[model samples]
Target: MRNYGVVIPAFNASGTIAETLLSVAAQTVRPELVVIVDDGSTDDLASAISGTELPIHLLRQANSGPGSATTRGIAALSTPLIATLDADDLWLPNKMERQIAHLERFPTTSGVFCHWRNFRNDRPDAPEAEAVPGWSRTTMMIRREVAETVGPIVDPPGGRGEMIDWIARVREAGLALDMLDEVLARRRIRPGSLSYGRDPARDRGYLQVARLAMLRRARDKAGSG
Candidate 1:
């Protein structure tokens, strides 16, 4: 099995983080290191983390958004492979195992991502395993070079669209990423979550991310020409 580390950016996720950690600990191919960046949570995050025995490196930073937290967590990782998970998400036992195998089979791909299904907070612990395309960071297992090449995730004004921006950069950098047609992650949809409710601010942030990508692409093309 390949050695990999996981980064989980958390902001006041005390209620759900334990379950998320449990899912990580339960993975068939467990991570060598788990970094949790606390974005200035007032909640009892320490208590929530005490329930897990996984190897954890905890970092505390003042109320930065998830993008900042995620960037910091990635900086602490030294493994060949890196994965990201939200503080409120869950992973199937074979998630890492399957991703590792896929990466090994496709040596040229920069990373591998799987599909995910959304479940409500009050729904059954195990929702239907079937899923649609999950192009989110939560389902990604990327090589370390890809993260280094992409650099830090860019935080948009509304604290959203950082992943979109980073993924755009990755593609622009000529790194190829592959997505598996299997479901390996579970996204919990709940009130107060970043993506739960549609907000005008989030919409604006996404647009900003797209605009930046377009500008970058045009600049790269002009330089090449």
Candidate 2:
């Protein structure tokens, strides 16, 4: 199996990060390296991760959005293959194994992503939701070279819709991401999370990123014609 590293971007994720790292440790195919970028979290993120024995490389920076933290964590790794996991998400035990298998089978694909299920903490540490076919950075495994080609993940204000912008850039760069039908990651829905609250600003951020994506597409089409 190819050696791979994991990047986790954390911001005030103390309550949920330990479980997240445990999921990583429970992976059927272990990662060669794990880097956690602490995005200036006011909470005790370090204390939370100290209980785990995983050889985690922790980096700290002023409160940057997930995109910046992700970029920093990815830059710290030297592995040929890189995967990302959000600090509040959980990966199924075979997530790495399945994604790696997919990448090996489709050698020309830029990356591999799997479906994710959203769960709530109604019962504490339990997933109380059905699986859904969706794309999330947490479910992605890609070659290091592909990440370089896709460029940095954009950090939009409020840390909303960065992934949408990045995916648009990926398509613009003529890259393809192969996705599996199976759900291999679980996203936690919690109060006060960036995506949970009914915040108008979040909606605006998403719309802004999408608009930029549309403009980029139009510009590329015109340039080509």
Candidate 3:
């Protein structure tokens, strides 16, 4: 079994933190270390997750946005392979196990991602079997070094679509990315979420990042020798 590390970056996620942690603890291929970057949550998220039975690493930072929080979580990882999930998202039973098996089978493939289902908050929903237009962080795993080498999801407050930036960078670096024909994650679509909220500004930020990702891809492909 591959000793894996799972990173979760959260802020003011007390409402969903416990459920997320429970889902992680229940995974059939549990992570050796699960680190939660509590980005200055105002609630008792730290206290709630701290006493869990599973081995967990919690880091507190001064609300630096998801990009910075995710970077810190990645830096703290000790395993060669790292998987990430958001506080509002959840994984099916064998999410990591299947991803790890695929990686081990295809050594040249630097990243593996599976299709994810959209859930209404914690309520379960059926998986979207088809591949989406682009990759999302909810269903992805990659080598630790490779992820950092390609560049992580920075440029935050990238709002709803920041993941596109990182995914494009990995492919731009010429690392093969493949998708598994299975569903292993449930992406929460809560109405109050920053992405789904009333703030049009957040949506505009998301659009900017999405555009930036496409631009980066074009540049990288053009630059390819």
Mind giving the per-residue lDDT tens digits that candidate 3 earns over 158-205? 355567667767776788999987877777778877645567766666
Among residues 3 or more apart in sequence or in different chains, the pairs in candidate 3 whose N, CA or C atoms overlap within 3 Å are: none
Please tell me which model should have the higher lDDT, number 1 or number 3: 1
lDDT per residue (tens digit) for residues 168-194 in model 1: 889989999898998899999899899
Score each candidate by Cα lDDT. Answer: 0.90, 0.85, 0.78
Candidate 1 residue 6 C-alpha distance from true site, Å: 0.5
Q: How big is the RMSD of model 2?
A: 1.5
Query: In candidate 1, which residue ranges exceed 4 Å CA deviation?
Result: 124-130
TM-score per candidate, chains pooled: 0.96, 0.95, 0.87
Cα RMSD of predicted structure 1: 1.4
Q: Which 10 residues in a row give candidate 1 its minimum summed lDDT?
A: 121-130
Clashing pairs in 2: none
